[model samples]
Target: MELDEFDLALIEQLRVDGRASFESLGTRVGLSRTAARARVQRFFDSGVLRVAAMVHPEFEGIHAFGHVSITVHGRASAQVAASVAQLPDTPFVSVVSGRHSVVAELRSPDVAHLSDTVSLIRSLDGVQSVDTLILTHLLKEPHIPAHGPGRPEQFDETDRRLLNLLHEDGRMPYADLADGVGLSRGATRTRVLRLLGTGVVSVTGMVNPTALGMTQMSGFQLHLETDGTTALSVIGRLEQVSFLARTLGRCDAIGTLITRARTETVDLLDRMRAIDGVRDVQSWTHLELVKEQYDRRPLRANGAAHGAAASR
Candidate 1:
């Protein structure tokens, strides 16, 4: 779909505050509430945008977080990726062109869960090998800064209920949320704002790159000749980059890039190689995205917890 200036502006504002009221959003984008609501509903109906809550796995009792690279023995890489995507602990899965046939982001509640996931992947038919890159620290994630205030010791039942409601719909109205969480409107507003300000949660809009005319999603694993900070300083500035992380593994750093055309991907790679400190770069163009979920945590009816079996 072609997005005009107004649509773009609305999207930008929603990215900052997904739960912004239609009246407030309309005011910001120079439209009436009815008009803005229509545009947003259209975007949603067409699957162009989604507003949802996302939490850092670490704060949610997740004991492990990392990327898993899988190699397939034959032409069954796509099938293997599909199988891995069904695993509950994995939230991101893609078939790509590179040394590894498939790559997925994994979140586990503990070491045992992580081990089970690894074993399951290894036992899959046509699987050749698996390599994991554990994330020691996050330099940047989504639009939020990685370094933030410390996490609270624990969440009460009310907080969990609020989080569950937001998980289902980040744009849920305060009155509805207050009803769901058994809080007054003012209290609900304050609690939600505090959760966002403290980095306990994030509510934002996510759009598929293909929906925006950027069809190619690729991964770049960088072996840097210079310090990671220097390399990231150069790469992180690029607008096409969606995810970036410094790692402790075979590659010094890795990142995902989105581009509109094959030529653009080539040009991007060339520019990346030209960076003074970038020693080598391997590009993996995604062939198929088996699964991608911004919010991996599962919500419970009682709001007792998050984390459930993986969904296909």
Candidate 2:
């Protein structure tokens, strides 16, 4: 569905605070409570918006995460991309136009598990080679919850069940959640509030860029001439930058940007180069998004390879 100014404003408000009361949201976006609720419900029903909990990997005991770029043989890019996208460990996958035909984001509990999953991707038919950039730190993630200082040491299996259910549907009512997890509604609400207060997971509305008319998306790898402190601060403020991370790889950092047109991308690249301490920047435009959901099941069941054979 096409999003007008009011719809976009409502969505933006939801992004900031998904659990905001309908009355509060209506006041923020110049709509009545009933109108705001109707707009949001319509978006959810039409699949234009999703409000879900995005967990912070480090807070969840996830240690290995990286970006894997795969090059494929002639006429095999689509098939290979589909195969890679199906793997449980690869949460985000997209076909792009550049040296690499497909790129996938890998997340695992440890390096060994990540290596096995990468090896499985390499073994896919028509796949040629894969290059990986191990992420060191997430410098800026507007969508994810801010990484809190402590991991929830008291986290248990019941917590996992609650988190998994929230990851699927963040707005699930306390009554339904309690029924699903066999807890009293009051207890379920208490635990959920704790999770949110601790920054373990954030339930926010994730907008589909295409529906908002910002269709062009690109990924960039940057080489830094310095420690990247200044670069990170400057780049993080740009509205176009949705995700940014420091990495241990050929490039010092990588980021994903969404723009309205190809020319805007070129303009953004020029701006990035002008930032002090940025030595070089390379980018690739996304051709198609094969998979974009954050699949937490793999990390939730740590040490289970899911058919990916161990690789040294």
Candidate 3:
């Protein structure tokens, strides 16, 4: 579906606040509430946009986040990627070019669970080797800031229920959310606003690159010879980059970039290589994106309750 200027404006607003009311969205986009609602529904039906709530894993008691690079045997990269995507705790999976056949992001409750998940991947047919880099720091994430150590916020049953509903539909009407959580509309609004203010929950639109005319996607592993800080500063401002992080393993920094064509991707990489601090760069074009979920896991109360109750 082709997006007009109004559609782009609406999408930008949703990216900032997915929970915006149709009336509010209409005001921002110079359309009537009914018109705005219809357009948004069309975008959803056409698979152009997805509105969802993403909870911070650290706050949800998930301590281990890993990026796994898998080298498969022979020419079964697609098959290996499919198997990896189906593996438990694997959220993001892609068949990439270069040394690794597949790259996946795994989230686990703890180190033991991460180890178990890695072992399961190794046991998959046609898998040659697996290298994992523990994600120690997140420099940036979609609609959220970098994660840091902070006290886990406490939430009661009512709060959990509210979060669960939001997770299902970030743009769910406040009236519907109130009814679902058994609270007055005003109270529900206050609670949701408070949760957002505290960074316990985030609601935003997750746009698919291909749907937005970005047909080429690639991952880069960069090693810097000059000041790491200066290089990160330069790369972070690049509009083509979607994901960037300071890694602790073999690569100094890792990132994902999206472009409209192979030629454009190559040009973008050349610009990256020309940066003063970049020493070595390994680029991998994504042949197929197997699976990607921003809201991969749910948030739950800590301790004994744990899996018994999930907020997303």
Best by TM-score: 1
- Using Cα atoms with residue i matched to residue i, what is each candidate's TM-score against the true structure? 0.90, 0.88, 0.90
**Residue lDDT tens for model 1, 175-278:** 99999988899999998887777776888887767788999889988888868578778888898888888776778888888999989989989999998889
* TM-score pick, better of 1 and 3: 1
The residue ranges of model 1 lying beyond 4 angstroms of the native Cα positions read 110-116, 143-149, 299-312
* Candidate 2 residue lDDT tens string, 222-248: 999879889878998999998899999
Clashing pairs in 1: 88-310
For each candidate, the alpha-carbon lDDT, in order, equals 0.79, 0.81, 0.79
Candidate 3 versus the native: TM-score?
0.90
From the highest TM-score down, the ranking of the candidates is 1, 3, 2
Model 3 clashing residue pairs (backbone): none
TM-score of model 1 vs. true structure = 0.90
Better of 2 and 3 by lDDT: 2
Total backbone clashes of candidate 2, pairs 3 or more residues apart or in separate chains? 0
Number of backbone-clashing residue pairs for each candidate, in the order shown: 1, 0, 0
lDDT value, residue 7 of candidate 3: 94
